[model samples]
Target chain A: MELLSNLALGFGVASSLTNLGFCLIGVLLGTLIGVLPGIGATATIAMLLPITFQLEPVSSLIMLAGIYYGAQYGGSTTAILINMPGESSSAVTAIDGYQMARQGRAGTALATAALGSFFAGSVATFLVALFAPPLTAVALKFGAAEYFSLMVMGLVMSVALAHGSVLKALAMVVLGLLLGMVGTDVYTGAPRFTMGITQFADGLNFVAVAVGVFGIAEILRNLENEHDRQVMTKNISRLFPNRDEFRQMVAPILRGTGIGSVLGILPGGGAILASFASYTVEKKLSKHPEEFGKGALAGVAGPESANNAGAQTSFIPLLTLGIPANPVMALMIGAMIIQGIVPGPNVVSEQPELFWGIIASMWIGNLMLVVLNLPLIGLWVKLLTVPYYVLFPIIMAMCSIGVYSVNSNTYDLFAVAGFGLLGYVLSKLRCEPAPLLLGFVLGPLLEENLRRAMILSRGDPTTFVTRPISATLLVLSLAILVLVFLPQIRKRRDEVFTESDA
Target chain B: MSTKPKDGTDIAAGLLFMAIAGFFAWQGLGLDMGTSTRMGPGYFPMVLSGLLFILGAVILFKAFGRPDDEPMGRIAWRGILFILPAPIFFGLTVRGLGFVPALFVTTLIASQASLRMRPLAALVLSVVVTIMSTLIFSYGLGLPFRRFGPWLPL
Candidate 1:
């Protein structure tokens, strides 16, 4: 009954005209970015975050969440219609989904993906509601030491999940933390790394860094080869799947949702991992394993379901602990801070409407994607034909406006250019940017917690190990680091990533 | 073999990391680093810088004798030249030329990053993008931005 009443309250808030409208806009815009290649949800969310500053906290967050899911749905559509997946999470979907399109079953593949995502999203939303409160209770009991160790674990997890060399990723994280340390120190008003620039005393703008690293850097990467994309616009027949196809997808969708719900709660890019994991699971379990990568319906169904579930449930960490599970969640934390709500376990008690509204909006947003995207698949296919050259200019202009509008500081725009160059160089060296971005977001918080804990314990270094929760988290981080370094696991990790890349 | 082949990309990356770490460490020395119980502003950064330096050194050391070595692909020189400067141009001129003109020029500069974009197409794209952004961000969204600045004499 308590859960039911809470659900009713959430629906009551989310179903309001203004909130619903924002949700629609968010998902639509999210899908637009998702359908397009080269631009990612992280970059689009970063560029558009400033615009949301004008709305109510709940409305803005609702819209942003919608964008996240809509982008996921849109990514799958592109994967099925064209071999190019608009997002990395949908890369596995492209394997069999594109094959289906070649066989004139693009409609079936798209429908399967949409249905699977919708089902998984619904289940994940319930799971978030059922589990978030309890998790928040645990998080609320955490002391400064526990928080510090937890963040250390999160950073370690991010480094572990990052692509390519672990050493390079660790360096990126440290570099990000150093970048975060640039502004004035909180404990003492002494300036740290501002380099005598007064404008940077408040720290480098988060928006500028995000846009530069993800958006502008992406444009540069895309420009390395200006090749034409092959769009499968024809033979998209039968919007609804047949009975046999529906039956085939049901099991994979269920298994995927289960796998995704669990993994999505983990830190560091769980949605991408969830989808890949689902594909491997489905392939192993399938009787016709040979059909995989050759238009198996489960390939389209399972990963799509797993990814959507993972994407929805990834919010658990953000909502419960105020820690970002991934980069997009980091931006969400930024949005919350800008809205003047200090993100933590207290948000559940202090801002129930904001908490529940977002949970409810996920279901609503998924429903809209299923209803609106199917009929509008033709339009999205058409968008795929737009030249990449035309798109980058528009993106650049938007990035300028978006970053400038954040603080109305021209220095932020200049920072965007600087970070963009830095991001491009890092990528050229084959370094992943995700860990760096995560480190940047968590940097100040991590330092604050470490300092607070140190002061609380009278500068005793053993406090981290003395506390049970903190000790456990540190052990976990150590275990993860060891696992990643082990020659066998390292080889397997590389194989997994390389498989997804192909 | 007299000498082991090295991964050029990893070598460059390692050196870059080391240089960055050294810079931060050198700068950190200027700030006050307090004792264990009462840490200074520079303490955490100094520790991080040291960690980074070690990581860089390890990466550099491991780069040699590795079998895998893929050539670094063609660099985006054109994109770097045009795309990187677009935001800088907008930042320098947005207050002077105002939102409309600044955004217009930014788009124009950015479009040139692609060899596929013709001059006329770029011009038309810039014009349309500027107008749409002006309408949406300036008027529709009601962001307080001057359409034209005093520099334009309009």
Candidate 2:
């Protein structure tokens, strides 16, 4: 009864003319960026972050959240049409999606992906509303020691999940932690890593680094493969799936939503992992696992549903605990901070309207994405026909303008170029950048908590292990690390890497 | 199968990182990092330098352990050329040429690196991109686009 009343209030806020307009714009832009390869939601959100400074807090959050999920919807379009995943989460969708495209079932694949995403998004939103308050109450019980332990566990899990050599991942994680330390110490007035430059006083802006590494670097990579460009060429046939297709997808969507909702709560887990894990789980559970990479509808349905669910539920950590589960969430956190709303336990109690309003808006946004994307499929397919030469320059221009717009400073341009080079090198070395990003996002929070815990404990390190919850989280992290390093797991890792080349 | 020559790309990269770490560590010697209660300006950088040193050592070790293959083709000069001139272009023209011209010139040069474009299309693209950006960013979004030169005569 309370939920319904709160939702009614939320609807009143979300359905406002201005809020609805921004939501539409966000979804439209998100889909456009998602359809275009190399431009991702993280970059798009980062670029738009500064602009939101002028908006009302709720409207800013509403639009930003819309873009986040809208990208998920748009990402699958390219995966199905051109055998390319716009974002990492959509990569798994490409496996069967592209195959379906090849077999001229492009319309069916797109429809399944869009509908599955909408369903999962709706379920995840409900789950967030149902569970977020209780979770926030639970989180409020955490002390400094517990917070530090949670960050440590998050860092360890991130390292364990990173693809490639465990040693390399660990190194990157440490490097990211070090990078996080490059600004003025919060506890003391001392400036660290400033190198006498005023700009370094604030440390490297995470948004700048994220935009540069993911967005600009992607454009550079696209330019490298000029000769191998492939536009999506499938003709659309059926827009709606038949009964058999629907029947085949039911279990996958349900299982995927469950998996995604759970994984999305973890700090390092994002849409990419959810999608990949869903596809893998679906394969394992299927009676005919051999049909997985051969244009299985389950492939499209499971990952697509999981990706959207994960994307939606990742908001849980941000809204409830004030912790961003991934880069996009981090951007959302930045937006919230800009809006002067400290996201945590008190967010619900203090500003019920904003919290509930944002939650309700997500449902409306998800519906908007489906309605917007279905008719626009043909248009997006047409967009693919634009030659890479013409397309890429415009992308690069957008990257330049977006970066410049953030500070109106040219130094950031240099920073983008520097990160671009670094991104290219990292890609060649098979080191995943996602873990580094996670480390970057978590770094300051970890340090602040560590310092606070130490002060509270009077310099005793045992506080982290003394608390039951912290101890449990630490033990889980260690177990995951050990599991990842096992010889059997190592062999599986090798197979996954080798298959990419194939 | 024929034997492949050992590739030194990893070793070079590792060595470069080590050099950078070493330089930063050296620089850290001149700064005071202070105690835990009254943290000095150098606290974080000093910590970063130490971690970077460890990362350098790990990278070097990994590079030594790997079996190398041939270098991956001439360091992709086209991409390098396309990306390198951007900062200089932005720095010089951002305040002087104003946002529109600077953006236009940068996009024009950057687009020229595209392997798919002929000279004719590239020119048309630069013009279109410049005009579209001006309209969307300046006119539509209400961002202030500075026109060329110091003072504008109305």
Candidate 3:
């Protein structure tokens, strides 16, 4: 009864003319960026963050959330149309999606991806509505120690999930943690890495790092293969899936939802991991796993569903606990902060309308994406023909303008360029930037919590181990770390990592 | 011995990272990190430097152990030139040229990195982009765009 009433209030807020318009704009831009190879939702959102400063809080969040999930939809389009994936989450979809495109079944493949994403999004939104209040109540019990442990677990899992060598990933994670220490120390009002520079006082901006690593590095990568034009021609077949195709996909969709829902609860286990795990599970379950690379509809359906589901559910941690699971969620947290809304347990009770409205808007946004994308596929395909030479310069200019508008700081422009070079080098070295981002966001939070926990317990180290929740999380993280390093797991790790190539 | 690209790249990256870590650690040593009671200023950075040094050492060790497997191609100087010179250009033009001209020129140079674009097409596209961006950012959004000098026409 309470959930229903809250949802009603949410719909009332979400259906406002202004909010709806922003949501539409967000999904539209999200899909466009998603369709463009080498750009991810994080980069797109970061680049657009400055534009949102003037928007109403609800409108900004709604739009930002729309971009996050809409990219899931748009990302699948590129994966299906071109062999390239705009985001890591869509890599699994590219396996069978590109193959289906080759086989002239691109229409059906796209339809399944769209429908599956919509269904998964609806289900996840329903789960959020049903569980958010209770979850927030539970989250309220978390102390500083518990949060530290939880962040530690998240960091470990991120390292484990990274595709390359664990050592390299760990190094990157530590590097990220170090980079995160650049700003002022929050607990003590002392500057740590500022080097007497005023700009460093605020620390490295997540938006700058995100844009540099994902957006600029991606442009560099695109430039490398500028001569190789992607072939986007595909014969449009049946838009809707046939009964046979439906039968094959239903089980995978269910499995994907299950995987995605669970993974989404874990910090750092958003769309990327959900899609990757879903694809792996589907392939492992298939009798003819070889067909996975040859355009299995299940390959497209499962991962696409999981990706959308994960994208939606990742909001749970952000709204309920005030901890962002990924960079996109971090930006959302930044938005909420800008609005002067303290996220966490109080959000649900104090701002039920904002919480539920955002949830409801997600469903509306998903429906909008499906309707908008189906007919617009033809137009999006036309976008691919836009020469990279023309497109990239525009993107770079937008990035510059956006960064400048944020604080009117020319220093940040140089920062972006510096980070761009760093990002390119990191990419060349096969180091994943996402972990670094996760570390950067979580680092301050973790340090703050660590100090708080220590102060609360009078510098007692037992605080972490004595807290049941924290202990459990620490144990779980340690177990995962151990498992990842196991000889057997190491051998199979390559298989799981290289599955992205499919 | 066949030189593997991965091995060589890893070693180079490891060395570079190690050097960076070393420099940071050295810099950190100059800071007065407060104690736990005083809440020293250098506490966080010093800890970070230590961790970075350890990680750098691990990377260096890993690089040394790996054998080069393939030959690496020559560095793409064109791509480097296109991207590497951007910061210098931005720094020079940002204040005097203002945001619009600075952004336009920087983007134009960056676009030249794309091997696919013919010089003529790149130039035309750069102009179009500059105009569109100018209109959208400067005029539509009301972001402050600098006008020309006192003697210059609008």
TM-score of each: 0.99, 0.92, 0.94
Off by over 4 Å in 1: B1-3
| Order of the predicted models by lDDT, top scorer first | 1, 3, 2
Mark the 10 consecutive residues where model 1 chain B has the least summed lDDT. Answer: B63-72
RMSD to native for every prediction? 1.2, 2.8, 2.5
lDDT of 2 by residue, A228-336 (tens): 4475565686889999999999999999998898888777756667887898899999988988888999999999999899988988878887877777887787778
Q: How well docked is model 3, in DockQ terms? A: 0.46
Go through the candidates in order and give the clash count of each: 0, 0, 5
Model 3 per-residue lDDT tens digits across residues A1-502: 8888989999898999989999999999999988887678888898888878777777888999999888878888888888888777888898889999899999999999998898898899888888778989998899989989988888898888887778777777777777787867676666666668787778876677777877888777666655655755658756888899888889888888878877887787567889988988998999889998899988988988898888888888888888877778877876687678987888988887789889999999999999988888888888877667777777777777776667666667777887888888877777788788888777787777876787688767788998899999999999999999999998887786677865
Cα error, residue A272 of model 2, in Å, equals 1.7
- Going through the candidates in order, the fraction of native interface contacts each one reproduces equals 0.89, 0.36, 0.37
lDDT value for candidate 3?
0.79
Q: Is the docking of candidate 1 incorrect, acceptable, medium or high quality?
A: high
Q: What is the C-alpha lDDT of each candidate?
A: 0.93, 0.77, 0.79
Give model 1 RMSD, 1 decimal.
Answer: 1.2
**CA-based DockQ, model 1:** 0.89
